[model samples]
Target: MAAQLVRAAKTESKGKPERLRFYYYTAGSGGAGPTILATSFLLLGEEVVAYNKGEKIKLKPYSGMLNIDFGKGIGKRDVYLLNLPEVRSAHDVLGIPTVSARFGTAPFFWNWGMSAMTNLLSPEFLKDRTKVQQLVQLFDPLVRAVDGIAGERVSMRVDLECTDGRHTLGLFSHRKLSISVGNATAAFALAILEGSTQPGVWFPEEPEGIAIEARELLLNRATEGTINFIMNKPPWMVETDPKELGLGIYVLQFRTQVVEITDLSGGFDLALKAADCSEVYSFEDIHENRKPPQ
Candidate 1:
């Protein structure tokens, strides 16, 4: 993706005397991944500008803030995680928003707020005071950080775990700090290919130059499948009750339309089905008899 961006920038700047400016607006885990890519482009002789929290800074080769060791095998490796103490200290002295594993401490509270309600109402976790205290300790820093905004002094620690599991991969780690490599890569690609005209900060999806064709191509490539780009249109234009769309799920049941494709093959379908006690299911089950319900 970085290579593609460099190529497009070079192509666009063929005759112009001024250098093409590349700005990478990154926060959270992007400070670890996208910063590296931007720094690589800088080393490759592309005029690149990198920013974190709207402050312009010099781009350095991937180091210091984050560290990784490639000596161990795939899921069994040690990563000297980010400097939490330094980060906390900076946030304390500079009055900047304290960064949580997620974007900011606000999300930690958001999750805790929802979880607290569930724990209070549900019998599963409410019975044990120790468990509730443990959960509180885990999130105390974030709460304190919020309180610190009002001139209160507080100390907090963030725990890091290294295990032989899917969590080893940063992108697929727990939701609190998970990063989507595909989305990030596509965002950079689109931003470069479809040069942004807007001046201030905006989401990749909000930009104008990225046409529907580019979006379709990117979505298909990233998802590795044909996409049905549904939009509000004719045919499926009936309105229904608001409760039909379940919580935490985004769905448009009215005025919906599907995009059609003419030439595509080797595509696959996935489905789920009910099984009986007599039926034997294998891990590699792909037979027509096991076909999923409509």
Candidate 2:
């Protein structure tokens, strides 16, 4: 399949003979490999892949999965340094809405299973807006940041977050123009095949002239690995949590320690003498073991 795509790409460029322009969506670990390959292609003068623009392709219907890996040494304090507030403001400036109506349903299903069904049927659940609002507050900023960076709507997002003792905190937001890191490689490959040779940053769905056959072929290849495409509804539509979506388990194994210390600057000499005494004590023991006073 890859051979066929390459041949077709070569044949299509028979007359143009220009570098292929490509655009990858995300830059996370998943996207890293493809991005490197695309960049290598450019360096070798084979093709050019940019993040600014490319031929928009229609992705098949599939459910998006958001994976969050949490365990030892992960903490909220660490996540806060990422500057989520700045991200949220940037998204707002870009006219991106963080949460969709379907967003509220993710947490209910993620943290609770059958209980979610029961809660959905409860009058209190229907009447209560605070829980859903709180969830929106937590997820909106995160989703915006992810989307902004990827240059495509991410159907699924995964990250580590601090978990409370009882409930695992998780949520999903609507994607406007973000792609998953998992899809980055495939997206770039598709762009190269579709003959995107333009410059500047671009979304995968932005360009035209992408053949349907080529689009389907590339989309299939793109989704083959750890990536998935959502054609119908978002992953949260099923009312499942990150764990249920095949996301790994969340475990907290990190602890912080606090130690108190007193300044000894004024008695530095005495402290040095004490240290010297300890060293001398060790030699004295050795000397005593060997011979008296010698």
Candidate 3:
């Protein structure tokens, strides 16, 4: 199937894209019983992967399984930093020079049966038709609620908030996170495939053309809800929260939209560039368990 996609991608124009300060945020749905059951591997113990100057580096992650009070939209659920195998192949195998690669998700606070469900749910294990029916009955609400979830509406969003020098805090480009759009990675993937001129197969690992197109898709994408405040600038410039963000990190929050954002900072106090995270993370020398994105 992957080979078929590669053949399909050959017709399109290939490119070298540098999408730094990337992040994935989720909200609204996805914390239900069915959703958690589907995406367990991505959430558990996965670290966000970044490729810079041909080095595959691991970024920081949130502590334990649940956020005590820090999670923005997930509400005491799980938001995990991820390392997609395809992204790794893009750099390691394809040798596509990558500025960055990242992904994250805020699953609607974990469902009650999250841990156990992950351990179970197999075709071989649950062979009986009775089990399948019972399982569907349990997650019927979640399945019915999501058609599933927003399509173009974007319940899951990927932010390519890269600057000449860029950094990230956990899943967001900014240290003090806020609510944004969610889910449309499926649409994004389909766009790449449907955009294909000739019939062939493709995998998640991007060819040059697919990588370039993916970067273009991520640019200036607005979420479904309307908002006045935006975080398009480099993390430090946007005055969001005035509290303990990052070194020189400014903040602003938008709850689903630009409503009651916590630590919403309007202006900034002029200060020297004492010590910034993006400055350090922007470089390539800090790999191999060295000082990384914090």
Better of 1 and 3 by lDDT: 3
Against the correct fold, how does model 2 do in TM-score? 0.23
**In candidate 1, where is summed lDDT lowest over 10 consecutive residues?**
161-170
Pick by lDDT: which candidate is best?
A: 3
lDDT of 1 by residue, 1-294 (tens): 212222233344333111111111121222233333222222222111233443433332221222121111111121211112233322332222322221111223332343334334443443355554565556455544544343211111121111111001111121211133554466657645665334554333333434333654553444322111111111121122112123222222221222221212222322222232122222233222132222
What C-alpha lDDT values do all the predictions have?
0.28, 0.27, 0.35
Question: Candidate 3: where is the Cα deviation over 4 Å?
Answer: 1-25, 28-77, 81-88, 91-112, 119-133, 142-198, 208-240, 243-269, 272-294
Q: After superposition, how far is residue 104 of candidate 3 from its true place, in Å?
A: 7.3
**lDDT for 40 (candidate 1):** 25
TM-score rank, highest first? 3, 2, 1
Candidate 3, residue 45: how far the Cα is off, in Å: 14
Better of 1 and 2 by lDDT: 1
Worst 10 residues of 2 by lDDT: 74-83
lDDT leaderboard ranking: 3, 1, 2
lDDT of 3 at 285: 20
